[model samples]
Target: MTLPTPLTGVVPPVCTPLTPDNEVDVGSLTRLVDHLVTAGVDALFVLGSSSEAAYLPDRHRRTVVDTVTGHVAGQLPVLAGAIDMTTLRVRDHVVAVTAAGADAVVTTAPFYTRTHPAEIATHFREVAAASPVPLFAYDLPVSVHTKLGADLLLDLAAEGVLAGVKDSSGDEGTFRRVLLGTRARADITDFSVLTGAELTVDSALAMGADGVVPGLGNVDPEGYVRLYRYCRSGDWARARAEQERLCGLFAMTAVGDPSRMGGSSSALGAFKAALHLRGVIDCPATAVPQVPLSSGEVERVGKYLAAAGLL
Candidate 1:
């Protein structure tokens, strides 16, 4: 596998703002990108899970890629996530985003099928071959249930396709194993490993993770930047403190339902609403079936943001 150059810093999986009519809000997107850049975010990852990528259509997804890349310019590297389950469709998305000037592609493992290790390798191999830019192996086994084994990663590294893997499974043991196995290897020139879970970001950094890719950064950009810088600087105490504050803002994501804070339509809506309240964007809307946050949820999230000094 082709190793990605050492990628350091906190890269947020930014959320996509939408118009009331369910169309992508280019204006809001520009505002959001500007907000993140001004807040000192290292990079912007578009069309990620936090962005509701799975619910977006191809046309809108392409528009998001162009909007984010064009707005960010070359100030920060912009990586776009490829969410289509079909390899052919994902390949097409990679080609599309690459043409749109994305720095790289972050793709999840196959979702519909129970992908075996071998199939995962094959899938990524095909996607890497088709993608003009490098591909980041997305390992969100919680959502897809296919953990990217260390042996498979080593094998893929041997084949020279992947740039790195995003370990979002939140399995510390698995993460440690991957790190130990890949750290001493000299064959994988650019294999960078990124931690995907937000709660474990500080711990992941302390464990020598290449970088952090968290969803919470979409709303609390400055807090995430501060937390990440602290971690990268090896200040666990300050990092932990900032993480606690970050978690407070993240609490707003559970305004409607505390049990399922993330991956909920309302939670995402709450995040966008919080961003809107903070004046970063306008029109806090979601796609079909998932409307904007309820009045109470919005109020709660707004209050939470205010408490966190974000609004």
Candidate 2:
């Protein structure tokens, strides 16, 4: 399927489901896809941060893309993340996911090795040249350790090197600048600027963002969809209410004790737990090495769900 020129609406960064043995749970993943699609999301983003793409092995990544793209069957755009440490490695992932039927590929700036802005621009251009499908830059400085500059992003957008960007850098100032630049620059057209921040969807949309790629959307797709519709219709009052409610639900990510587990363990574990409690997926287990949420923490997740009326 051809990606929407300016992809809009709620696009959930999907969560990967795993079995006890740490293998990809195809059945659970399919159900999770159905849950999101049925909730009126515009597209599905697999192998994103929410999907634990960084931790997934190459084989597991391939299986995830194949499973989701096959199950979606063109019902909506299936964007797979070609997340890696550098240009060449990201290119290989791009090839793998596109061959597995992904409609587009999302990638972050090169990491682990220190890189200059010139090298970052060169990296994206090189990957875009090699990719068989549309490429969306994933601006996640928390992991990549380098924030994307709005000027550089706009320059690339003008040159057609990037189809869109998923900004997860948590820099509202830069995010708003990019949004405004995308709108004001005559040279940059048909570029989709999506937010990967869950708690700021309303503010992002108000700032001319094209859409949202909220990981929390995996747990409460309907809420995000409603928030999107409210924003598009100019219902600020209703949109704010819904967004605040969703933000309350998002507090589940902190249910796990910080001293006991890492951020990935707490956030992803809470999401999978919510999905399991909602009966959308079978198992709530995350990948290996990441600690599981304690039973009490899982209960805390349930409380958040119940408060949000997801239970």
Candidate 3:
């Protein structure tokens, strides 16, 4: 199937399913994918930050792409996360994602150690040149210490090295700058900017962003789909109300302690927990060491869900 740029709408970073034995639960994953698609999401991004790609082995990651691709059957755009920090690893992932029939690939800047803007530009240049599929720069500075400047982004877009970026820096100013930079280029219309932070969806759209990649979309897929539609339709009032609803759900997960409980530390765990609540997936299992929600946290999540009418 031909895949178009999902310039607007919600693309959920789906949670990775796990077996009781702790393996990738392929069956559960397919069901979850089907559920999200049925709920009206514009696209599906696999092995993303919310999908916990860093925990899985390369083989497992490739399996996830294959599984989701087959389940989706080209109904919507399918984006695979390129999670490698090493050049060789990133290239290998690109090869695998293309071979698995992914519609596009989303990649984060190298993390753990920060690299210069020149190096960042070079890294994406190499990937974009070698990749068989379009590359979306994953710009979540919180996850990756290195940030992509709008000038660097413009250079990449000019060179056709980047299809777009997912701006999760939580910096609306930077997002606006990048959006304006990309929008100014006639050749860069193909370049899209997605808001990775749920709280910034409305602001990003108002700033001329293309779309959003919200973790909450994994659980409340319908809410996000509705929210995006409302925004695009110029119904700010309804969109604002929906955004508030999602923010309420996000607060519980965002407020948890991350040191002792790594799962609670991430939106991924909260995403899975919400899925478990909705019965979309069998278990809300995050990899070990990332502890599950505490009783208090779970109760708080329940209240948030009830208030949001998701429970």
Off by over 4 Å in 2: none
Model 2 TM-score, 2 decimals = 0.99
The global Cα lDDT (0 to 1) of model 2 is: 0.94
Model 3, 63-149: lDDT tens digits are 899999988988888999987886667888998998999888888777765677777777888888778888989887776777788
TM-score of predicted structure 1:
0.93
Residue lDDT tens for model 2, 48-68: 999999889999999999999
Which sections of candidate 3 miss by over 4 Å?
255-259, 263-266
The best candidate by TM-score is: 2
* Better candidate by TM-score, 1 or 2: 2
Best by lDDT: 2
- How does residue 36 of candidate 3 score in lDDT? 88
Provide the TM-score for each candidate, comma-separated: 0.93, 0.99, 0.94
* Global lDDT of model 1: 0.81
Give a tens-digit lDDT track for model 1, residues 1-311.
12237666778888899988889999998988888889897777899888889889888998999998888778888888987776887898888898999888988888887667778788999999998777888888777777888878766865778877788887888888878777777776667788987777788888888888877787887787888889878788999998888777777766765443334676788878888888878888878777456788889988998888875
* Better model by lDDT: candidate 1 vs candidate 2: 2
